[model samples]
Target: MPLAVYLLGLAIFVQGTSEFMLSGLLPDIAADLGVTIPEAGLLTSAFALGMVIGGPPLAVATLRWSRRRALVWFLAVFAAVHVVGALTTSYELLLVTRVVSAVANAGFWAVAAATAIGMVAPDAKARAMSVVVGGITVACVAGVPGGAVLGQLWGWRSAFWAVAVLSVLTLAFLVRVPAGRGQAATGLRGELRVLANRRLWVAFATIALAEAAMFGVFTYLAPLATGTAGLPASWVPGLLVLFGAGSVLGITVGGRIADARPYQTLFAGLTALTLACAALAVLADSGPALIALVFLIGLLGFGINPAMSSRAFYLGAAAPTLVGASVTSAFNVGNMLGPWLGGVTIGAGLGFGSVAWIGAALAAAAIATVALALTLRGRQPVPAQARA
Candidate 1:
């Protein structure tokens, strides 16, 4: 815990807020643009697509910059996107702004994890990364709900304006973060060099599958809770707070588990999450049971994030920067794919309950991928604490 860690948390908070606030603002955007609710959801898709496409390439390209300069520059870019997003009136212009925002997001996250790890002692890496990612959970607890309120009161556009202001503040404080050189990813060639490892692909598969499961259900969660659970639309906000609570618990518990044995923890988390997702989807009819299972899914599903990320870090020892970029890229790809796939299922007449099934399937796939990685390594088992 250096003072810089707090800045890292704040930076992530701003990023997470900008990224997730769209869910609550969709109706306002849809009304303004005269699009269907489903179509308006593309705002999220646009941002995620930008992140997926930009993350690794940006990481590879910016590998030459010092970490502090890179972070400040990226945050500056991130802030500008939000500013444009706040000001734009044309829906098409808004989409372009979101893409710009996505580019900043992609680069910021890739560097943020690497920067956070580099900031701390080797043993403290997991804790530091967890603290940084706390911003995402904070968004769940505060950002989404706050944005909803902001959108309702001042208009949806005001939420973007609010985010723009916060982004500028984050950039101002980021001056306090320590500067350092990031590993040069060289370019696409450098990135491909790391991808040369088959094991790395296994790790990527695991990351993608795990996120696919989590986001598929989560992206459609508001509708599912309302339609399937027989709950009021207004209750969606309160329920999301509960989801955030579970996520906070899961991330902390999982971060500790990762310190013990990152890959082993991934194995267990994936398996447990798969079960929880399956149970939730199958039992959505029961009010009490649905709440309990949704919470369980949130708890188990999110617990794997740090471990899977660390696994990428270890497996890509030869190319830490590329690995960092690739992990984030994989994460975003899953984010995009998850919602699109879930939306497709629903459009094809599948019930909201299928969200959990999609999640369960992805989790099971992730577990199998990681288990295979463990078998191939053939590393002699060490005691859990020693692994940490």
Candidate 2:
């Protein structure tokens, strides 16, 4: 593995920790700020919304800088935002801070793995990208659990402070990595043209739909557990650990699947996702059933991420960075929509089971997107659709 991959992993760790810690700390935040849990959850939505709005504009605006400098400047902005987030007391102020932090975050994801892939040898690209993305799974497996523990031990705000410190470490490590081959603005403009292709939209749709369903329930999982899963509040953390473990497996293995039979794995994963969501919706009446359902959902849902990512990589070989960031933006789009829909359903007195219905619908949409991608890719007559 290149040093760049390690640095990307670390950056992702802090970034993931910074973004994801909201769920673990929400209860504490609610208590401290005198707000309902649902209202407090806007912190997560605010971040997701930031990523959705910021991913492209920032990437396009920073096109003049080398990928390395762009990443550094992004990390710098990200670190400052975390500091601001830690200091803010008013709920509205914190919301604004989270939006700023998420902008930096959107830029980081847009460039980091794509930059790392450029740094290493060609044969090493897939492995390097996997290692870079692995940080997200690692965050779920460890960083988040640790943050949750810290929240339990001290306060929710401390976790953000911890992420801020980690950001510094990530920045220092990232500084040492070579910039690799720099991308030009022409390449970005070329990427914009590529984006207009119908197949690319299909691929983006596939990613967005899958993410929305997966995260929708995940956002409100703690409550989902209490409502339908029947798991005790104490058991939620451990269950999350299990989900993290499965996610680690998914991320590591997803790459291999992409290398082997990309389309097959994708279709299978989407199909399984639909079935899993349907099954969970039907079975989400009690503790043990919900536990089994949630685990199955996590295992199956996260298992295809690498496959989906790689599919986009191959399909969008024209403009890697733009497509890469666009896929991530699609991810946050799902992130924003899923929870909002879930919250609406829950607020409407629809139980946790309603989440599965949404999940199933999204899964169906994802499969349709994949079908469209495969169809368009197979029929693409022009050898050079755009540029890489």
Per-prediction TM-score, please? 0.93, 0.93
Residue 212, candidate 2: C-alpha displacement in angstroms = 1.2
Off by over 4 Å in 2: 120-126, 185-188, 382-388
lDDT of 1 by residue, 1-388 (tens): 6778768878888888888888889989989878889777777878888888887788887878887888888888887877777787778888888888888887888887777776776666666767777778888888888998999999998898888889888888878888867666455565577577777788888888988998888877777877888877887887788888788788778877686678777877888889888887888766677677667767776788777777776656555566777887898889877777887888888889888888888889888898888876776442232244
Score each candidate by Cα lDDT: 0.79, 0.78
Question: How displaced is residue 183 in candidate 2, in Å?
Answer: 2.7
**lDDT (Cα, tens digit) per residue for candidate 2, span 1-388:** 7676787887887888777878789989888878889789888878888989888888777766778888888888888877887777778887888988998888888888577666655444556666777888788878999998888887887887888888887788877777754457456667687677777777778888998888887776787787677778998888787777877776677655665676787889889889888887887777777777677777767777777765666556666677767878988888887777887887798887898888888988999888887778779853352223
Separately for all candidates shown, the number of backbone clashes (residues 3 or more apart, or on different chains) is: 0, 3
